[model samples]
Target: MSSVTIEARHEAWPLREAFVISRGAKTAADVVVVEAIDGAHRGRGEAVPYARYGETVEGVIETIRSAAVHISSHADLTRFLKPGAALNALDCAFWDLESKRTGIAVSARAGLPHPIAKITAFTLSLDTPSVMAEKAARVPHLSLLKLKLGGTGDDLRMQAVRQARPDAHLLVDANEAWTTETIGAFLTAAVECDIELIEQPLPAGHDDILADIPHPVPLCADESVHTADNIETLLGRYDAVNVKLDKAGGLTGAMRLVAEARRHGLKIMIGSMVATSLAAAPAMLLAPYADWIDLDGPLLLARDREHGLHIENGIIQPPDPQLWG
Candidate 1:
């Protein structure tokens, strides 16, 4: 077996503007990048340490450094670390390294078809109804728009956005800001606004109310579902799931979740944290299996990595091997 070396670093990329959600706002994306080196081959991966999940940049880097001593192979790395941003970075680095060493695309190694360019959902940050509408009007060419909504005046926000871009398909993400009682009202407004999906209207553990309600607009679980282990419990409550590598650990776990979610007839949505194209590339591989794609993280940044995934009129081009697998 060839010897391996691991290095990790934290990078902060400024966002074009503040990305506001129900929880709060962020001006920059602080991410941990992991690089695995084996002889002449090198692999790289990036992950954002999410504060909502009790993750910090320093903590993630430490976790990667500690795990590097024991992880000699990609297979070992899978079971070596728990599902989170730390493992995600290392896992993706392994995939990238293997791809470079063997000259095989990561998709081919995973038994997935070659990915093609696809339309991705452009996100509109949370703001007042009129501000949201103005933002929506500016991106008229984008076929899909994912709106960030707070519990209050969410209906008005949806209405204004709908009025601004009548032709675009809309997805609403409340980010667990709404209560069980308010979700029904939101769904009612979603229907009126012709919204196709409403994501994580209620908090994760408080989603029991979903089982008893009638869903006019399909509800997608962002926080309520993580890896495949959480899928069975969400069968009746959620119509779809938002899979992010940061949340699923890496492509390995995300693929498992995708397969399991599909087996249970749940719709799939490939989502991302506000990170760079390196972080978005791995998630794009799963876009083929997803009903909704939201890999617009790099587009939200002021500048992205060299040779990053290309986005033209809201469509994402496949990643170059140099950028990632």
Candidate 2:
């Protein structure tokens, strides 16, 4: 095997303006890009901070730099970084580099026979009821929509959007806003509005309540589950788990999570933190095995790096190598 080295670069995107949520985001998003080089071939990956995980662009860069020595030695990608943004970027870059060296697409290497467009959930950031409703109305043709909720005002926000886009398949991600006492009532309201799934209603440590409460909509674990290590704990509390490349540390852990979640009879949703197309492409390798896909990272960007994944009408096409493997 040829020795490869990984390098990290930091980039930023000034949001067209501040994007608000239960947590706050101001202008300019900080991002880290990892590039792996061996001989003349190169593969790249990008990772973005998840405020939920308390990650920043600088922190992600530091983590990647620490991993660089191991990546140069070509140590096992699967064992290096704990599940988080840094490992996710390196794991993806390694996979990309390997595919390029061998001239094989990730799907083919993973035993998938063909690549096709995947239906994706377009996310609506947390906002006021009327504004969210107006935004939902514009996406009339989307087959799936993921709504962000978690504030004091979410009830009206959800109701308004659901009222406007009644036909769109809807799911809600509270990002750990609702408490145990509120979960049942929230699910009740969600079901009344025909919402299909509710993700991460409670914060990670406080999820025991899920086992006792009856959930009308399928409940999915997001903040609560990372890597395969957390899968056993997540059972019975959640019907599904949202697997993000950043959260699992990369495709390696993601595949492990998929296999184990199937063994435990948990539905899988492949997702991404808002990054760029370079970040989303690696995760696409596992989408064929997931029940729902949320690779809209590029969609959230004011602009994306060139030649990334192409998304149209809320469907994500397979990766084009001009972007990343």
TM-score of each: 0.99, 0.94
What digit string (tens of lDDT, one per residue) describes model 1 on residues 213-237?
Answer: 9999999999988899999899889
Tens digit of per-residue lDDT, candidate 2, span 1-325 = 6888778989886564455555665566677898889999898877876767788888888877776776563356645667788887887787788788999987777665477678999888888889888988987878798888974666677789889987888888898898866766777778888888889998889989899878778999998988888899988899999998788878777888888998999998999877778888888877778889988778777888889788889989888988877
C-alpha lDDT of residue 235 in model 2: 81
Please tell me which predicted candidate would have the highest lDDT against the true structure: 1
> What TM-score number comes out for model 1?
0.99
Clashes of each: 0, 1
Off by over 4 Å in 1: none
Show where candidate 2 strays beyond 4 Å.
none
Best by TM-score: 1
For model 1, the local distance difference test gives: 0.93
